[model samples]
Target chain A: MAGFFAFLGDVGRALWGAWTFDTSMAQWFGSHPDALAISATVAVLAGASTLLGNSVVLFLNRVKGWRFALSLLLNGLGFVLLYLTQAVIVIAVGQLATGRTVAWETVVEAVMLATAPLVFGFFELVPYLGPGIAKLLQAWGVAALLVIVQVVYSTSWWQAVWITGIAWGVMQLVSWALAKPLAALGAWFWRLISGKPVLLRPQDVLSGHQFMPVEFDFQLEPGEAGR
Target chain B: MIVSLLALLVVVVLLFLAVGPLEALGWWRAEGADEAVTTLAEIRAAHESVPEPVPYSHYVVYLSGIGAIDGTSIPEEEQPLIEHLRGHLPGFAVLNDVFPYAPDNRGLTAARPMARMWSWIEKARFANPEALVAMLVNARNAIQLFVCADRRYGPTYNIGTAQAILHSLFRAGYQLGSDVPVTLVGWSGGGQIALGASWYLGRAGIPLTVVSLGGMLSDDYGIDELQHLWHFRGSNDGLEKLGGVLFAGRWPGAVGSPWSRGLKEGRISVYELGPMQHNVTRHYFDTKTFAPDGRSYLEVSAEAIEAVLLGTEPKVIPVEK
Candidate 1:
């Protein structure tokens, strides 16, 4: 339990360090032999936070039992994969923009560390104000990424901004291009795990068809009309 | 000390926020409609004893405000209002046994993990004159109300609430698919519960009308599904106005929202009750406070509700500025 708290403290410090563009954060990540493992842990925390925050999907779909557990695990894995994809995109963009080589591990570490803001993603569970909070967290994550990039890559703020912007744009384009296939893959995986076809649309969830048909005895006996 | 207090307040707020979603999600785990059967059975037995037959002309399900702790308990101040409503509205069976806070119609003091703690809170609330402990009850129920209005949790929570309501209606001898109108009279948070349940109730072919008494309602529910909504707000009820301000969907600018559409289509009506406060003394249900016409506030509110139920224009009582 103490180790867990210490790790939590480390995560918090790393996030704060990245946000302030502290050189020590970049040095800490570079010197650590378990940098990749630590980055993966951060990515997983972000993934889990997101799943818990927007768990309406699980509830709406009525996913339950071992299937629910599987969905959470798979979704978390999906988030980690997405983060890894972002890290790779950032590294590619950084290398091209700077014309200087940086360690791939360092770039991945920075990307994952930047996502530390999203650990508060559970705030998305809040009603009405949740979406606004989620948006603010996303903006914070982007800002953190810019700062982390500046610190890690030894780039000027403007260069970091350009790299982050290009990377984000590339990620968006890649996501848009692969959106259909990715969604299909997700649905297929969901079916394999849950043994049910996923209800993809919010309308489908709200359609009231998922509920059991309640049988009401509307038939009134004679002389029961106006009692 | 001030910083510590501020930190504690923040923690409390966050905890309050977390509790709603957690409770709503818990329903998914306990798939069975786990109602407080004892309470439902008692209510059902009471309804059975009524001399009236299978269907009354109308069924008014009264959802109490945040002060409600259980299905069986009605706040003392509001009891007279219910009695007044029953006395005036002939052919209407007023069912107030359904607890609006829990989606399963389970009361806080019902047999559950938190029952003991809730019971202690209830005791402390009454034992203490300050009644600060009562705020816990209000805050807890208020969170459930938000869950009912929330887009993510609303559908799940509302479905369960609708099911529980359907059970209560059946027990009350309400004929499903009957042309008889079912009016949900929700006070404060109860208003949102009524609106939430209307979606499923309407789908079941029940003609639904919602009567909100200083209700903190959101525009998330199926307003189009409601036959009509009569929202009564006391002039001094700033808390009631918070619904309109807090929910962006309630804003006039949200032209696509159900509430805006309901307003445009004349399915929703807002009425101003004369200078009544939202709660406690001099509230809508306060029997001691009388208008210039010599009718108590409870009488005036009940009469207003009766008018809406009867499809007549409610006479506005004159009040002192």
Candidate 2:
């Protein structure tokens, strides 16, 4: 009973962290209800795609490289578009830091296994610490990645940590370099489809607008402004 | 020893060809349900819909029995009855050909074989549909059925059958409870599936009607979820009674078969056929006793369903052996 309660407490604290984990992620997710709905749909499709992709790899043993590529492409569907873009960059950076020419499968498998602990990301649904728990899980995930790296590469602990840390740094820098243009592109497309200028001055919207109107001429519903 | 084993493999292959795939594989568990696809299957329209010749509005999604249901061509044995029923009810009917132990689209068989070749061969059409091969070559009449190619009959996976049916119905444009109402019709073990699907649909508060024709009923909470249940059982159907006797469901009290209580409560209608026997619909002549009578349980049950769909007074069959 005590052990059970301890486990519960651990989960509770972890969830508390997740609730407060990443406010920016939450803000980004919450800012657009339409995007959130689309993400949920993508999550379901991603799950289906992963199952199909993995099943194909496991069952159909012939032409492995093509099958592996197909599996990766299928998994990318679940990447939540830009939602997981940062996560990939982070993992890629960790991989580079390891400085080992490990098989892609080994790294992919290790990363996949390490992320199992983040199943606690379920806590991300909790109001208070959802984001914190998620963010903490990312750190936990990194530590796990380091252990995997050390084992797979047969390296010293310090080397593993250094590899992971530098790799993450590299990834973060690269993602930072790329995120702006992608976000701008996504935002521009969003405005085009929604017919609403977002994050753009009216004159700039007009000047650059090959597609969308350069006007924010509508009033927000009183109850809808906060959302 | 190698030559003997090679000969044995040949014999096994020949046996599979003779008895059909289900018995050959003894395998019921399969992956890849094609969860989203509802194949439309074959449909029996009462008359011409383009000229508005008939006032056909309702849909009955047909779930086949055990190993009998397959992904290949729709069984033609069912055509005579559906044709007869469509004329009266103008009720459009489609076969839900989701097989649990049938062959897959890839032509790959299950890795395991649950039934012995001799045992399966002797009964012919007793359990699974015997006309599987003959039915395979039967021409499709442009109607669609949501096919779940890898569905096997055990309870562990039957829910997938139900879920697939639910999605198929939704895709077919039948609103949950209203507008175009839905009725689930299952034969033999398929009855359990209809009831199980009813449970899921009921929990969602969707109005449903489940019609089980000699379906193997289990004690489940879904029975209470259905708006109405029409059970057609022959007195000679030993398997239908097997659920109650083996599982201890049909007891004197309401512990086993909810039929007694549900019958009294007026939510369930039981049609007890005396001369009729199990497997009499598709395999009518396969059994010695019911085959001589030359009556198709498919026709009888279809009429009973027609009554339910038409909202007319139901004709009652007395319980007799």
TM-score of each: 0.86, 0.39
- Tens-place lDDT per residue, model 1, A77-181, is 767777789889888888888888888878888788888778778877876567777898888888888988887778898999999998878877987898778
The 10-residue segment with the lowest total lDDT in model 1 chain A: A210-219
- lDDT over C-alpha atoms for residue B304 of model 1: 88
Give the alpha carbon lDDT tens digit for every residue of A105-174 in model 2: 4444344434434544433322112334447756876776566556656678887777667656665676
What TM-score does candidate 1 get on C-alpha atoms? 0.86
User: What is candidate 2's lDDT per residue for B155-208, written digit by digit as tens?
Assistant: 213334455665566555544324345678776655766775564454433457
Score candidate 1 by DockQ: 0.27
DockQ per candidate = 0.27, 0.01
Output the number of the DockQ-best candidate.
1
* Alpha-carbon lDDT, every model: 0.76, 0.46
lDDT of 1 by residue, B121-185 (tens): 87886676347777888888888888888776776688677777777887888865355789999
TM-scores (chain A) of the candidates = 0.80, 0.46
